[model samples]
Target chain A: MSSSSSADSRRQFLRQFGLTAAATAVAGPTVALATSPSTMQYDDQKKLGFAIVGLGKFAQQQMMPAFKECKHARITALVSGSPDKARKLAREYGVEEKNIYSYDNFDSIKDNPAVDVVYIVLPPGLHAEYTIRAAKAGKHVLCEKPMANSVADCQKMIEACEKAGKKLMIAYRAQFEPFNLDAIARIKKGELGKLRQITADHGRSVKPTEEPAEAWRVQKKLAGGGSLMDIGIYSLNATRYLTGEEPVEVTAQEFSDKSDPRFKEVEDTIHFTLRFPSGVLASCTSSYSIQEVKRFRAFGDKAWLDLDPATDYYEHHMTIGDKDGKRQPKIKEGNQFAAELDHMAECVLQNKTPKTPGEEGLKDIRLVMAIYEAARTGKRVKV
Target chain B: MSSSSSADSRRQFLRQFGLTAAATAVAGPTVALATSPSTMQYDDQKKLGFAIVGLGKFAQQQMMPAFKECKHARITALVSGSPDKARKLAREYGVEEKNIYSYDNFDSIKDNPAVDVVYIVLPPGLHAEYTIRAAKAGKHVLCEKPMANSVADCQKMIEACEKAGKKLMIAYRAQFEPFNLDAIARIKKGELGKLRQITADHGRSVKPTEEPAEAWRVQKKLAGGGSLMDIGIYSLNATRYLTGEEPVEVTAQEFSDKSDPRFKEVEDTIHFTLRFPSGVLASCTSSYSIQEVKRFRAFGDKAWLDLDPATDYYEHHMTIGDKDGKRQPKIKEGNQFAAELDHMAECVLQNKTPKTPGEEGLKDIRLVMAIYEAARTGKRVKV
Candidate 1:
């Protein structure tokens, strides 16, 4: 086989057997070592360093705390518009003062060897710009979900990363959550029979806060569309990974309370249905006018699996059942963001494509755009 | 107030407090008595007797067993295409030999004093014919859901019953299911804040059985559409009642495995999005190619409510909580089918229109047709 095909085969073998670098490195004697990265084989325990952009509530509260749990990843750099907040967090996280950079000097990170990956936790509008810059800086990129505001921007981010020969991963933390990962593995194993339908919903009530970090979410230019780009991407991405298929057509409806000032520039809620190529269907809902709900239920011919609160950073639980009765699947709870960070670090260290690659991110953004278009036109949009 | 207005006020009051005859007759002075039906006020304990048309598996297995738990309803007669089966069931239920009639002599039920109502449990194509016949024979009608095969047929069933001065109810048992009832009450009380979105899904894997009752479901002329008419109606009706508003527009997608002989004449799956008058959106799915899953989740500004296995006969459960954590609501389980039967009986005895009146049934049928049209043409259909 050609060198590329040989590498692809090894990647497939590892993925199929549910072997991560941590597991394979420990089971070296029994497992084939040809696919194992040289660093892992030699017991090189170097952690891939991440430079988190935008020291917002999500970064400080979720991502920063998650880094403490990550085995193969650590925060080595911090980029923020707020110098005081960035400097303070850097000191607390044990990062050097020279590693902190503002948005204006973000490109200067090319000379910073410590920052091996640029993790963009910025607003949707800034994702493409920072991701491309990170790729150009010879660092891998781990951008947050929704990829970018538009399909063209997502494509640009993907192309820039590819051109620079740098890995690009989208931080779809749900994909790394225990329950969601378990569901995917079981579905692939045909535990639920042939997959037929997926119903996913993710939303939370968004109240206006005094914090500047929350302000950009309600802005159309910064957030892309509305709750859809902010929270609905969870449902959209979950359905794709669960079905393991691309949706061929989409029909959507947008909703917003005209009297509500918060919805003046964005939709409060949007519901959409996706029709996959294999005649499978997925119905999803995303909203900003509701309390938190993250649920994913996949139904197959023989059985069904449900994960209520599916996308939580921790405490994700699941039930595997059919028409007869429900059986609780033993779930191991962990920080999803941490798992995601570790996975990205492994991909970078091993010179392997990310499990959630830029292409996967691009597919979802394209679908998000199609969903918005369908809702606006009141017609089905092919993706 | 005028007599009609006074009657409306009384109906509204009883409905608001969820004072079914079974509850009010037992609660006595603790609950308001002014709204109590006069028939119940006079110490009347007479249970309305029903002549169930179409002695099929559903009627035999579910509705028949449910009658034992009903407070104000009983099976006084049985009408069937098979004389032997009807006579056998009538004998077991302690009905007189003369009370049993084959389809050929179904109109003879008019003369039978035991038959206060005709519950049509036939195939969709037969529902209209039998409902009209029973209405002409001066019996109140409680037809099973989907109302009929066509919108015109649903209208005909309504007019015939109206002309006969008998109550007409469509057996939307999910509305009477305890958990569903609790959700409606909570939403109406603003306990969950302003309702913003509803997501409902109902479906089950339908494999063709040797029984003739299962055969008609796959036949287009008999069952109308496929999954939408049979099971999708639950999601559609739940959305309507939950929002207390009609959907202004609907967009839907259809799916069917053509290789499966069962779907030769109908779609196996359908996903639809309903846009309500107040901008609330409901995304729904109905399928015949999956294991049992009936779930309804309502999201409001303050909180959310979920009913998993929402429309089941016995095992319905619920949880009411928001983003913080789940708070289990004390769900009172009851036989939904029995509750539905009692409601129809009470409506007849009290000279009141059923909550799921013929008009309500007609509205659902219209939307069902709209959904099918949208799915077929791949365009938004106005309801």
Candidate 2:
């Protein structure tokens, strides 16, 4: 490779793995010296090798491009349930044919030192198992959200990474998006004054489609719930982050289309309230049978900070103001997916925990569980 | 008075009340006839006379000035628990000495035709009694809020007015404030999309005082609770008006400094959530031991609207925007108090129901009651 491309590769590798200068100086030469016939060889400053495990639509469209442009990381391996699609993606991305793996041979990847990190972009139910297997293969993992279907599953995933001495990060993209970050920073800085309330909502209209025998998302054993686990988690996370206070109590109500067979085992809509220790109250809602909208607002004694389409799962805007005035059109430009990946890489390389760490995800899941329990029991649940 | 003075007076009166051409035709002749006692027989339309009761701080500052400038309304009478203050205020506001009345003589005013409206600016505990008395006296009534200390009191006030065939309006200034009205209009028009969440907060620091010889505001029996019943009512009303929906269920928590002598019988702070039938959720907070701030925000799919320092009890701003962009500083001009009084006068003169009528007050009081009950019972309360 040209010197410029070589430097770019090193930067990309460092960015992806969050490798600090000290860590790199120690492990860089060692990794280079250990290369053998089957091992991938790289200079101390070369890019870190990464692969996406699920060759699904989201992975093909969004995740692939993200890796391609990452300064410290590169798409060096491809894995998929479909061998044909994996080979196709490898060819299109200029990844080597030998670097491709299928579900059956995923274990063999342990010997492929070419790939250092695995991005698990599978369906919800598959995340825990794939992540744990990737950890056993000595690869750091970036898993798609809801962390896992249950608290036990999430704990298992975390423990697997711990045992492997590898980083495991949950993809909560909104936490890294600038607008949301700015809002959190402003709240921390007391821009809104003493925060007294937070309101968050995530809603969308997603009609049920007839799957060819089995679609993981429509199965309760896979996706957890239709809307709450899918989109409502955003509301829950955003509320906690913006308030900067742990919820002490929760009360929730849920409604489902019992007449609609598509709602079989999941809720179509859910509403919940969280009371924080600071006396701030948060009201949140998530719905799948509604027009799309995502928002977060924090109100204080002097002012307020608000994000419309706050958890857009992508780009959004932020506003800060008080009774006397407001500042808006505060542009938030960039892809949250890229931002989140970048943050995860930095956390891993720098030996720092992510802002939305495993514990945060676990806490959110706990709140979601509490909401479900409250809905079922018709009683307030202590968080 | 000279015809020129009479004409100038009429013009000033029209300007003060914000009367339109239609209102002028209805109220001008009667006011002119009433003021020109020597030259013209008293015409009811010209004699939109009003009495100021309870010459306390708020009445002395806000109501007195408002009455002075009201074109269709004149300060024809005065009533006070303190006779000396009543006589002095009557003199200062140009009321005839004979028109002055004390608490003992208030019933005698029923026989007098000069006063048409009784503006009860009393402490919360006295509102119901005075409002009921005014209704019995064949006078329209504008009662200062918390409407009353209890739901039973509010019902009594409403029944008294209904039985006497007079208009009864609550003094919820925020309902008439232009920016707030604009927010309600925008939300009603679906300018921000479909209402999904509303967050509101109102707070002010409690001033230290030593000579606490039973200040009615700090007394539980008189003020009901602390911040929730006092300032928090504004947040409740604003949330309902902005969403145009009554809350179906509520959950709340309250805090009190048990060790502080001041909080002996009332809450120091409160937080609550309201769930409306449209699946919209409202989170609100009120505190008396914090820096002052008031705000409200409504989020929808397409856009969002916010008012910071929303009910500043003075001035505020409104902002509107969507995920893609925003148009802020939308309606940040004008005095909220002036706007509210203007709207109230227009409502009365135009035979329009006040935006915050007795019913609106009742609903807010009901919600407050539910919140208090929920906090006490540690359970969600249906409204």
For model 2, state the Cα shift of residue A23 in Å. 40
Off by over 4 Å in 1: A1-45, B1-46, B210-212
| Interface residue Cα RMSD of candidate 1 after superposition | 1.1
Q: What is the lDDT of residue B60 in candidate 1?
A: 85
lDDT of 1 by residue, A1-383 (tens): 11113233322322322223223212211111122111211122378788998777788889888888888998888875455566577777877767777555667788889889999987787788788888988999999987988889998999999999999999888888878888999999999998999988888877755443455667676677789999889999888889888989887888888687778888889888888887778889999889888888999999989888788766776888786888988877878888899999999889999999988888888889899899899888888
**Which candidate number maximizes lDDT?**
1
How do the residues B33-125 of candidate 2 rate in per-residue lDDT, one tens digit apiece? Answer: 122112222243564677777676667777677654444666778775454555567667777666666555566678778787788876576
**CA shift of A103, model 2, Å:** 4.4
In terms of TM-score, the best-performing candidate is 1
What's the true lDDT of residue A35 in model 2? 14
In candidate 2 the C-alpha lDDT for residue A351 amounts to 74
TM-score of each: 0.86, 0.74
